[model samples]
Target chain A: MTRARALLIVPLAVFVGIVVLLYSGFGLGRADLHPSALIDKPFPDFELPTLAGEPPRRSRDDLVGEVRLVNVWATWCPTCAAEHDELARITGETGIGIVGVNYKDDPNAARAWLAERGDPYLFHIIDARGDLGVDLGVYGAPETFIVDAAGVIRFKQVGAVTADTWRDSMAPVVASLQAAAP
Target chain B: MTGRTVLGITALCIAATLASAASLVDAYDFDNPALEARYRTLIAELRCPKCLNVNIAGSDAPIASDLRRAVRRMLEEGRSDQEILAHLQDRYGDFILYNPPLSPATVLLWATPAILVLVGLLVLRRLGSRRDAVELTEDERARLDALGAEDP
Candidate 1:
């Protein structure tokens, strides 16, 4: 190629690269949809009190042997409340188990919120101090994780799981995981 | 006002300011200076997972405070710096650290500056070679000599 043509190629390649990069970055629908590092890894070990404040506290051992959605939520987060009904509907329709993590919330307030809003989870782990939330890399409430039968995390959905979210993003993953389960 | 009274008021203000500043720093008591220094350094290096761009030491978020406490606790437990960082990384991934570890995913991020420099040097060399490749025609050389001679 001529020197001018060679020089032109460099800038053209750079422009094309930058355009592709920018377009891909913008194509990502949500800014909060960060990729979780714990995907495909076993759930973090924790033996925390149940939200019911009963005996037989739950731990990582309880997560195995089932395909479930481990949802991180709190009474203080309004988005969690907003998604509560949708979550219950999802469980009702899909027959998929949901385990709740009551992160960094007052136990009384959390219990009241669940009772008022209607509890969707099979059981709730009280992460009152957020220690278990930290262990699970939960930065905010309304985050959901799909854990396979082996207790391996398959996918993480940040923010509230509305009906649309379940239909589009989460339901497919859950279906696939359930199909794959023994 | 009398000079003594004025000095006493100024001293009081200074003392008050110092006390307030001290209160701003987290009061985690360390058994030794080395442990305290390590705690400070670790918090400074660790990014606040909840915030946009602030390190744990600089952020006031609840998560940042919790991370700060965790770092101090680990340091007291006799964990090495790498161990502490790895502990956070295992949960939060490499995003928790301001300086990410070199891996297949981050190779491009770490290599971009050097790649830019290499490209710049190559361009510079090409330009230099092009300048050298240019040979003035005999007539042009004579004209250039004549212009130089006229300057004298």
Candidate 2:
């Protein structure tokens, strides 16, 4: 009887183990948080119009000179609005440059949004048709990529950049890339 | 209506429905039948990055549509299936492929089913041998023989 009970316990333990593993997997925050394929890869070449409309166009060459955050945003994305202040704060506090990609948004609406809510970006790349966004493997808006001085993408944050995300996750990456810059 | 006429009408309705559904999913025209077939196969194989579990062929998301367009463009450009898939994989990573390539990270994912089967077989073999090893004691054998004699 004791041996039979022990054998039963083996199956029960296995069941419990699988449940724990699955539970932990689900608890790891957003299900969409998969690793970006562009990590350590050179930023995809693009020559898109800037949000200001004065320079008319900017290319990958302009972004290569500094360690910066390439943030994908659109006026339609509420999460981008939510993180707008945090982005401004990041640049103010860390002195890091941010380049925006106005992904798939109306240029007028994007410019109006920036005017109302204080633009933190050094310059905004107009990805009006999401051509550059597709090249960057962007599935959604408000995704942020940390690009090194040499134009390599070091890391990517899929969702909004909250204060906690900035302090804990993105700040360290940016700092390390800055430290390693030639 | 006559039964024959009704049957013909029903068959026509079914064909029309199927043709509409096919056009909805695959709106792009291909001059070559082989290229069209390849397009179908590729879309079915590629997962929609924006949607959960749905392949690009089944997903109605904008990104899925964009990817489908890319596939069509590449197919028309005379690019091989491998080159087209590699292009997307380069951008979207292994997640876009329903059938993940075998790599060090994915070896366990591909191997787990076989491992489980092997372990199950080993456990079954051990249990079978244990049952086979169970022999009757001398007293039990004597009782069995007595019962057998009485039965005869």
Q: Can you write out model 2's per-residue Cα lDDT over A85-154, one digit (the tens) per residue? A: 9999999998999999999899999999999999888999898777787788888988999999999999
DockQ of predicted candidate 1: 0.43
Compose the digit string of candidate 1's lDDT tens values, residues A1-182: 59677877887898999999999997776534346567778888889899886754988888779899999998889999888889899899988889999888898998888778788789998887777777677778888999999888888888899889888988999888888887
TM-score of each: 0.76, 0.80
DockQ of every candidate: 0.43, 0.48
Regions of model 1 farther than 4 Å from truth: A1-33, B1-25, B123-152
True contacts kept of 1: 0.47
Model 2 stretches with alpha carbons more than 4 Å out = A1-5, A8-10, A31-33, B1-26, B123-152
How does residue A181 of candidate 2 score in lDDT? Answer: 87
